[model samples]
Target: MRFRRYLDILFVFILFTKTTFAQGNSCTDDSTAGPDDPHSFDKAFDADKGYGYVVYGDLYRFDCCGTVKRWDFSIGDNGKIELQIWRPVDKKGKIFKLIGFNEYTVTNKNRKSGFVTFDVPDKERLSTEEDDVIGWYAPGDSLIEYTDGTSYDGIWKVAHDDNLKVGDSVDFSGGLDQGSRTYGIQATLAPNTAPKFDPMPDKKISMDINVGTTIYTVKVDDADPADVADLKMEMTTKNDFFMFNTQTGDVIVQSTITVPVGGQTVTLDFKVTDHCGAEGTGSLQVQIDYVGDPNTTPTTTKAKTSKTSPKVKTTITDKTTTDVKTTKETKITETSVAPVATDKNTDKNDKTTAKPDLSTDQDPSNGTMSAMTGGSSVDAALIGGIVAGIVGLIIIIVVTVVCVVNKKAKVRPSGKDPEKANNASKDNAKNDAKDKPSPTDKKPPSDSKSTMNGKPHVKDKG
Candidate 1:
């Protein structure tokens, strides 16, 4: 009987052990599951089939007995998490609507079955951290907490459906995430609004008239797409359009008016408008050409005419007239003085003009003229005076010859005179003898001369 009790006890112990093992190894079913079963299974009977487990809040895994055959979560096979629906829940558990989505993904080497999953209950699901929420509150789309701690601020692209559950695994193409968890939903982007731009008008137009060529330049800061079209320019002279460039805003015209030479000021009007109902009008006063007065001939002029013959004739006539007048005056003066000169000569010969005759006892004719009175008498008297002068001259010549003959006779020596020199000597000797003592009477000489010998003679003479 004791042996039979031992067998029964062994059977009970084995059954208890088996029940403990089965309970320990069984997997819990989760909403976040892969293609495998999503419910718990009998570990003792169907351990080789799929089972459920959870990772994070929205990821799950399925194990075949001891091996995990498949895994998934609200995140995708790329280990990305999807926010099936995220909204702000009030303290009473009511949800508030907002605008974008939040989702993310996780990848690691420890992932079996190519993925990881998790089942998140209502309490385990990520709640919006007040600081994590963004954008305006709305309905059907919003961002929530992600596994990566980031949030999605984009618009909703996909609506919530049966495929998306509280803890169902969802693959998100867009959203925010942290690790294996994600928040918010996918959203489509609104069409981008084209940038608004301001229209620009043409500016700073200038014209250069250098070297007889007119260059026009149009300056512009910028232009809108619509304003860039419909730009035109025209050039005019004297209110007439000579040339124009409509497209490029360049206008060059051949000018009929010559450019002024010095300097001139002109006005240019430019009318500009764009398609956007914008208009600009400008006027420029440009200096153009130079000008001068016309050529003119001198008004004041003079000519000089001259003749040679007439001047010579005038000079000769004046000289001849002067000579004739001088000759006539000279002749008249000479004729007037001739009578007076003759009378003076006759008066000088009159004897009555002289003192009374020295002798009164003279004949009338003789008394009137004496030796110089009558003409014939004067002539005969002159003849007699000349004869007397000749006779006196002859006498003087005879006297002079006689005086000369006598002087010559006196100086001549005569042989019959016995040579006066010898007679003079003998006379002189006799005179000397009469005047002096004879030689015998001469006193005896000094003793030196008395002796007739060769003694020196000495004598005293006065």
Candidate 2:
């Protein structure tokens, strides 16, 4: 019986030793496992560094095992434990720790199925510590207490080796420790919000002028008043026309009077832009008056010639002349008168002496006579035929003289005047030769007859 008892004890001892060894091996096997190890846990209870232990509450502990468990105790619940924990060691040992408090208003069981998320603080001041917190819990410790006061203790397994992405979900198990629990807490990754931007609007305005016209058509491009706010236009006239800008691009007739000739209009355009980068434009139209060229009267020129009347005069004279002439004549008649007185008595006595007296009586008689008569007649006539004939002759002579002078002035010698002079000189030389005596006249005087080369010569003198 003693032997059997010893055998049983030894067998029990061997079984116990095997179990302890297997447990210790299991723990040691997962100690070096990474956080992402499928079989290892992500969180655990740390007692030496006091990172995940509650002073008065139950100390929930987690290991590298795949199982999730929780230990409830008053001291573990009261002990201060950081809400967030990270483990860099692959071995199931907690390496990093955070300090924070947790309120207990509800049991750990009621705090399951939700997550704790951190966001930018709304009113909390940032700490200047080396590990300053950029964000805090959204609901804060109060909201965490309101939701459920729970102590978490579980393994926090990294689902992936990559850092937290923009949108990642973390599952929290129901436990209180440095590990993420599926029931106690949960976390959701959200994308950061983008900033708002407001840009100024783009605007442009332009104007064009057409010479000599009051009316103008304005063209606008990409113009919208609502897009471009605060637009103003001012127009001024230069020379003949006024120009200004309106809200829209259009032709506006601003002048009521008729446009003068060669007149121009001035226009101005002002545009503004809105905050949305839109543009608006306007144009001004000016009416100009037309003026015609000045009217001018043409001057006339007249040629004048003075005229004078001829003077005429007439003279008359009257005169009378008297002339007297006288002539005397003598006559003898005595014998006849004496004879009549003595005729009676003497006839008787005279008869006796009558013969003797008759013979002696010689009667002598003489007579003288004169006559006068006067009358005169005169005749006058004009004859200019000879003078007219002489004048015609003189005109003919003048014409002849002019023609002769013209002919003489145009006379020219052939072969130039010098050639003609040379020809004349040649003619004069020939004439001189002809007028010169022959060589015989210069011969020496030889006695009557001269002999040359033994030839005899005879001469006769005259």
Candidate 3:
């Protein structure tokens, strides 16, 4: 009877052992266990210096939409780190999405090093979903560098399922101790912004020009308010007539531009690049032509001259002879003239006389001229003789008058009768002679007979 009782108790013990083993195996074998399960860490190790508890930090998502075929991260501490993915339920619960529990070991080869890539599991992609969180459980304390090169003491980020677009910011927080955290990280989608050309140049440019001159300036319009002082300008076209300054965007004429047939056009291509490697493009076109040339020839002119012809004159003469009391008819010609030159181009009505011979001779004795002449002339020899006779008679009358006046003057002084006056003169002379004593009678006295009358006369000596 006791043996039968012991066998029955052994059977009950075997069944109870089998039931406990099955329940334990169910918890350990379940790969899609939810976080609410009491034994959720059945596959996880205990928290120790070599292993740490799983930490659910903030959620992370890609800045843009993309498929993450591979992932990499830096290990700040030397230990194994397990990357886990979680998807949110309706309200506040989360479930583990298996990635074969991708885990990596950090050593001297990969400690504080570059990104280490992880192997993705088969038939399962670490895709992004809303309310998804990429988490990490570092078995030890660690640090990570921010985009600004600032190091923060914490566990590094893994992956995110954010829905933000490119160039949008993703701000998150991290902490060395789980419950105490601060917003310290931000990342932006690649290709932050597209470049643009603000304040673009004018579409068409116009200018007026004089020939043989140059256009020395070009316009540049760049609306970027940033520091354009260092912006670069490049002209793609190669033309000898123009040169451009890349530093200043100034276009100058290298030489005088020449116009071609059917006019001409100059095309220029310009590109501006900023310090950020973003670039903008623009173009310019110019048309030019030559109007005309500006030089000509000259001509000549003449001056005028005026001349007047010289004149010739002639005179006629007439004469009558008084020597024999007769008037004679004789042809006489005298031409008083000055030297003159005749011109054939002179007016027909203008009678220009020929030049006369100054060496011609004329008669001097007769008051008549016997020279050859073309016109009729009359001699005035009779009138010349009468004039000479009247002059001589006048001269004789003057002389006779002068002589008679002289004779009268002499007779008046002699008392009107010369003979009687002469006789009276003789009588007066005799009387004077009788009354005058002669010089001979009053002679100087000498010792002679004249002194006998007792009168002494002394001879005078001078």
Best by lDDT: 3
The models' CA-based lDDT, in order, is: 0.31, 0.28, 0.38
Measured against the true structure, the TM-scores of the candidates, in listed sequence, are 0.18, 0.18, 0.23
Which tens-of-lDDT digit does each residue in 247-299 have in candidate 2?
A: 54333433333333555454454453332222344444333334322232223
Residues 1-462 of candidate 3: C-alpha lDDT, one tens digit per residue: 999888777755754553233112211111221122221112222233322222333324322211233445543445666554433321212233432234567676655343344544422333232223444445454322122111221233323333422222222232123332221211111121112333434332222232334343343443332214435668788887667777656666665455543446778777765433446676667665433221211222222122223222322121211111111222332333212221112111112122221211223353323322223122233433343344334434444455557556765854357778879889999999878987877986554545424886454556
- Which regions of candidate 1 deviate over 4 angstroms? 1-212, 232-242, 258-263, 292-462
Cα lDDT, model 3, residue 347: 16
- Residues 155-213 of candidate 1 have per-residue lDDT tens digits of 22222333333433332223222232332212211111111212323232122222234
Winner by TM-score: 3
What is the TM-score (0 to 1) of candidate 1? 0.18
Backbone clashes in candidate 3 total 16
Model 3 misplaced regions, further than 4 Å:
1-229, 292-462
Distance from true location, Cα of 109 in model 1, Å: 27
What overall lDDT, based on C-alpha atoms, would model 3 receive against the true structure? 0.38
